[model samples]
Target: MIGARVRQFRTARGLTMSELADRAGVAKSYLSAIERDLQTNPSIQFIEKIANVLDVDINALLKDEAATNSSDETAALDEEWQKLIAEAMESGVSKEEFKDFLEYNKWKLKQK
Candidate 1:
């Protein structure tokens, strides 16, 4: 699933196998194998190379959907965040205000 997600993100970026290989400094054939799931267990270094090439977080490459939040939970969070953002926009909050809100939220979470 992680392999599939990485390939999806990579393709969405319009990167060919060889193009990504060049950007990641990895071999094209190994990258192909990784995409095809022929090699189920790629090393962390290899995964990091691919993630960097994709301009994505390494956590994105390593995510296990089964162990993470369910689609329903994520959807709920998305809906809530969207509502908050809409409200913020309607309130004419500046970008700086939004940045401050995000920072405050991060601090609040850390305290938790």
Candidate 2:
């Protein structure tokens, strides 16, 4: 999951693996391994290097879904949707309101 999150954030930032590896000062092969889940455990220093280049906190890189709040759940969104979600967050749209909107949309679709 950490591997997936790293890849997601890296891709969302429009970075290629080579680019990220170079920027993070880690080996491209190692980064690729991490992304592919071939390497399940990485050192803290390694994570810090990648996270710094990715512009996310170390905690964000390590957090499990159950530990996540509503905003943290947006990390998996595609780039366009991420932008929309960010905009909504910045506009102060509460999580409860978003949940209500989603439920309403589902109901509306069913009615149709």
Candidate 3:
């Protein structure tokens, strides 16, 4: 289950197993074992490393597939939104700054 999620995020990010293993600093054999479900109980530190390399939250890698799929479907971003977010990230706009902008806009709307 966790392995599948790791593979899903990894592939979605266009990273091969070897790339992921190399970036995460884990052995390729060990990563392969995890993805194959041959190693079911990876340590928290290992998971953290993989999640960091994958650019995903740890829970995204740990959640059950069914639950994750349902939530992801409901939370899916449109392409424009995705592009905007990517642009914002590339421009170095911190999440806190974005949140502050949103709050300011909300307050402005209330005033109007």
Candidate 4:
């Protein structure tokens, strides 16, 4: 199931298995095994790498397609927000720090 989802997203993005593997820093053979369902239960970190490269939410890769649909506008907005959050996470910004920043921003907006 996860393998099919990975393949679907990868193809949808016009990325070959080799390209996806290279970009995600994953072994191509491992990625192939994943797509072929020879390897189930990939680590979260591996999924995260693929999701980052695919510019998709992790849930999209984990959940069934029927359950993942939304308005195009919402999907686009969510994709952008996911990218931003991923960037913050990669830069070592803790969730608490992100919440603090959001709270600060809310307070600043209230002052206007």
Model 1: ten consecutive residues of lowest lDDT = 78-87
lDDT of 2 by residue, 1-112 (tens): 7888888778766679999999999999999999899998999999999999877899877876533547644634545665566567658998899999999999999999
Comparing 1 and 3 by lDDT, which wins? 3
**Ten residues in a row with the worst lDDT in model 4?**
74-83
- For model 4, name the residue pairs that clash: none
Error of 3 at 56 (Å): 0.7
Q: C-alpha displacement of 50 in model 4, angstroms?
A: 0.1
lDDT of 1 by residue, 1-112 (tens): 6767667667656667888899999988988888898888999999888888776788877885435666777845744664565456557998798899889999999998
* Ten-residue stretch with the least lDDT total in model 3: 74-83
lDDT of each residue in 27-89, candidate 4, tens digit only: 999999999999999999999999999888999889875446666776567556655675677
Candidate 2 residue pairs that clash:
none
- Winner by TM-score between candidate 4 and candidate 1: 4
The digit string of per-residue lDDT tens for model 3 on 1-112 reads 8887787667666678999999999999999999999998999999999999877789877886456455555444432454566467658999999999999999999999
Clashing pairs in 3: none
TM-score of candidate 1 relative to the true fold: 0.57
Q: What is the TM-score of each candidate against the true structure?
A: 0.57, 0.62, 0.62, 0.59
Over 4 Å off, model 2: 66-112
